[model samples]
Target chain A: MSGSIAVAGLGPGDAALMTPEVATALADATDVIGYIPYVARVAPRPGLTLHASDNRVELDRARHALQLAMAGRHVVVVSSGDPGVFAMAAAVFEAVEHGPPAWRDLDIRVLPGITAMLAAAARAGAPLGHDFCAINLSDNLKPQAVIDRRVRLAAEADFAIAFYNPRSRSRPDGFGRALEILRDVCADERPVLFARAVSTPEETLHVVRLPDARPEMADMRTMVIVGSSATRTIARSGAPFLYTPRSAA
Target chain B: MSGSIAVAGLGPGDAALMTPEVATALADATDVIGYIPYVARVAPRPGLTLHASDNRVELDRARHALQLAMAGRHVVVVSSGDPGVFAMAAAVFEAVEHGPPAWRDLDIRVLPGITAMLAAAARAGAPLGHDFCAINLSDNLKPQAVIDRRVRLAAEADFAIAFYNPRSRSRPDGFGRALEILRDVCADERPVLFARAVSTPEETLHVVRLPDARPEMADMRTMVIVGSSATRTIARSGAPFLYTPRSAA
Candidate 1:
């Protein structure tokens, strides 16, 4: 089938939250391509070609998917959360914008999906209420110097920070480095919220001081939110959600 | 009708983006209440009692609606973006949590909605690619000192800052004060993105340097996104969107 390509957001790992349009698009697509885990979430449908790849081969996989689209296959490039929020939307656009000549004319629409930040924020009861920032501690493509600079700036601004790709087996100390930068710039007593597997069955959220969050508590899949000084942990029924209001008063 | 109230997120501002479940819930509600502007967006349907209120009376309106629900009316409390992200969801919970004695037993479901931050970020082509923070510049309930401290911290952390409730006629100098504080902490050359009326026809996005942005450009309806030092303006085909990459390669 020949049609415009759509980058759909499968909101927050739950199939129920997927937009009807996205669901239809996925069903209609001749091929579905994404990171293995994200692609695995969709139930099997008849006549759909699933192209899954390892996490590290994103660019290559994206290029291959675009080429499939160029070859007259309606392809849906999937991402776990909203495709644009650090997902496959940008990668697809970058491929089309800078890739092979045959893939330039394909129609691409980015469908909104639930981002982890929004889902996690909701799960954590509004840590993002005030100004907040998200940083991916994965230094695979980015240099440590740049990450440090951004982290330092975010801490100085007192923006609550959500750290994605915080720690992985290969890069174990990334989250630690980020915490160090934030602690140095902000206060050590600042509230840091660690939300592991947010929205999933293994979801765990805890409020800890910046100094108390250790590397062992986080992994690549964990999304950590470090709040500004104004952020406080309020306990409701013995559960704490970090909240930063428009004003502390 | 007095089962439970779910405040689900209608993604961004488009009906197409709204989740099916949320749309279904809205359709099934006997009473729907919200700020007038948001209330106007819902397509007419039979048996839906629409309660539209002024912006200032959101909390009161929410309480009134919840009371209606508690009185066995199927009620739906609507907000423009995600209800939880600085919207009516929190007010609903707050009312239930701290309001009069009658609200204790009402089943409260704070369904996630697509927040303006995510919508604005999408419109601006991923200004929230990395760590960023959102702060409401309105000092109605918050003190200026608190706002200043948070802005300073976010700037220092180098977050892409999204400013909600940026300005109003009475608080004309709010944005100016924020800009000044942000300038002191962040680089003067950092890009500031003003998304006025996002997800609506009159939507206009302006990208300017922090030092160059004027106070008159923003008002209460505007959501300002200030990019990190890593954020860059790609002058592609005379249109620019603020982008912060997962990595600063």
Candidate 2:
């Protein structure tokens, strides 16, 4: 009897934002595996076991889930946002591609969830309402030159950009360099939104012009969205509504 | 007495894909407005008044939603995917920006859901696991030159590209031209995933190489995902798994 592996997304932080499909997957799982914070999001039951690992061990986590499933355990690997977007789904696939040939025969499913960028965009209005690009700003996986080239081209292409993993303790200076490139390429006051811990009680949103954006404004938990030239803002009583119009002239 | 409006995403044709936050908004709404097909997805209850409008009238539909809210009616303007991504959220904000001063005072919120591209990526493998750009291939909103330039730059940037509205009845030749541009820039056999009506009964997925891909493979309902240079495919018994690796060369 072979079991299955379901890679699920827990959504940003709000429990209400999770889909019924993910909730059902959690209820049916005998083993759950993920990062420490994400694994903590799932409730423990009588028949379930939780495996929480530290950061930077995505490949190891993927292998553990695969091993459990191959051993006939119903395993669910959880990610914070959409599993397909810079999350556990990719890591699991990499493992399967390099692991035993039998791993390909296992039933593996990637369930979509409300990603951090989408959740952040919703909280700050539709900053990504038009054509846009989502880039993982951390240079751990890719070269810095690649990140620089993409940001410059994204500015030249006039696409709204959503940046994931903007800053960390070890990689604090990369985001500043990215900002410098954006300022060099885009010579305007385009709105930039730094949405931290979106949908959570500790969520905070800050909007600034491109020239006013600083490196320290973002941390690891923040999702930074830089608007295109066509993006607009509407000021009322509270925070202004930010959006890119449907039509681009 | 004042009323508010909530712009909610229904997700990609699956009831289970909808977020509980959106379900709550629909349950609390006195009026619901959306495109004809999307509005039909909502249940016909005694207290809810459903306004089903035709396509291309997004601005008018948005204005109607604002007017209903201003008239002290709780309204939910439904979009098929995450409202912030190429959907009703931008149109609603456009209406609010151009409407009367009182409209700005109306409480408006955007509740995120699983977008079409994310859902399609999930149904297939995690083809969008790396940095990617989402472009609306429809020329109705932006100039064809703009679309072509963005596609060229996206290919040059080596970002996985997700094309929305690849082909429509009114515009058939744009996707072909866009494909030509990709063929010229990429010059290699990258994978392309054509996912149509994902998560629905009519859902279909086709994977093809860049040279073998045809313009007719996509329709208006299709979400086309072109892999980056780092994307890999694993062939097994059934459909091959497509995913872009997390680390780049």
Candidate 3:
């Protein structure tokens, strides 16, 4: 059999949100490789093997997947959200770029899925209806200065911002500093959406004003969306509808 | 039957790219409303009514969907990409905010899908693997100044930028000006991807350096992605792989 690697996204947390393309890729794969939680989402079958690894060892996981594929195994790397967005696709590509030249010739395809930010935006109404920026809050790969500068510039641009990896056990203070910067720069009553584990059984969406938002509201599983100046709320009986209008002020 | 409005994304173009959640919503919907082309994507059935309206009639279409739902019809407002991203969700919310108070009581849900930028990014490798911003280059709702400022600020922040509606028949010169600003600000050989009709039979992807990219290379159907400084390419026999490294330089 010809060896291939398919990096597929499983969507946020819902099986229904996953694309048929990704589902087909998973079905055809001989080996599924990803972080523990993501790989666990895939059902094990008689012919399929699941290789779940630790979180921070993305490069090692990528190398392993590549090695398996090079040895005539069909490998699928599963990611919770779209693989291209802070997921396994880039790690696999990073490995391929620096690895043996023969790895570049392998059939590698990235199957897109419903990303967390978009799923979160959908759950909370259309807070990202206008121009928006998605920033990864974890400073493991980038510097805090880079995050601060990007947040400041995004606020200045008045773009709705979606934050991923906002708070983790190790990086608890980064989101707090981000909130402080937003409060300082935006200084308005724009809505902030704290969407945790969206599209899952534990999905809980909280909409608060900028002044009232706390950093502790978000965790590693949470997706945070800060509204632009134009983002407004429509008062309803239940949770208010939060959406950024197509028109700008 | 209770009245409901489900704002659903149909994914980029391929039927496989559409989520099962969206497919289920469409199957259960009594009426489907969207732009002419998008609505035409839906297969006609015995009971389902597809309202395919002309372009620039988003507000009217939204109001019509609301009216139908209020009359106890299950209406699905469809968009090519995720409904929450510069699509029908915001338009529906805009109508609800200004329309009758009873409209707020209706059951409304936004179903996320594979957005054009992400799909495009996946096809060309992971160019949006790092911090990125999505900007709508259409000046129909916002001013040209707002787009220019956001583009400038996004470039300054070194965020991989995705441009939607880069050029239209009515707005021909805007993308050119935006390109000039990018060239002036970036001033590097960073890759720019023009992904048109992604996932469809007519799909075409072109990659070029910043200086070599031209405005006419894009149209309303194209999703243009400008890579950040850290974005790189791996050359093989076929088309090169484009990806942005996870690490910041």
TM-score of each: 0.82, 0.99, 0.99
lDDT of 3 by residue, A43-125 (tens): 98999999999888889999999999999999999999999998888899999999999999999999999999999999989
Clashing pairs in 3: none
Q: Each model: TM-score of chain B? A: 0.92, 0.98, 0.98
Residue-level lDDT of model 1, residues B108-205, one tens digit each, is 55556667777777766666766566676665776677677877766765667788778865466888998888777765697888888776778888
Which DockQ values do the candidates obtain, in the order shown?
0.40, 0.84, 0.86
Tens-digit lDDT string for candidate 2 (B15-95) = 999999999999999999999999999998999999999988999999999999999999999999899998999999999
Candidate 3 chain A: worst 10 consecutive residues by lDDT? A135-144
The fraction of reference A/B contacts recovered in model 3 reads 0.89
Top DockQ model: 3
Tens digits of per-residue lDDT, candidate 2, A158-194, equal 9999999899654677889889999999899999999
**Candidate RMSDs in order:** 3.9, 0.9, 0.9
What's the alpha carbon RMSD for model 3? 0.9
Worst 10 residues of 3 chain B by lDDT: B137-146
Q: Which stretches of candidate 1 lie over 4 Å from their true place?
A: A1-3, A43-47, A96-106, A143-156, A177-194, A201-214, A230-242, B1-3, B28-30, B43-48, B65-74, B100-106, B145-153, B176-194, B205-221, B232-242
Name the TM-score of candidate 1: 0.82
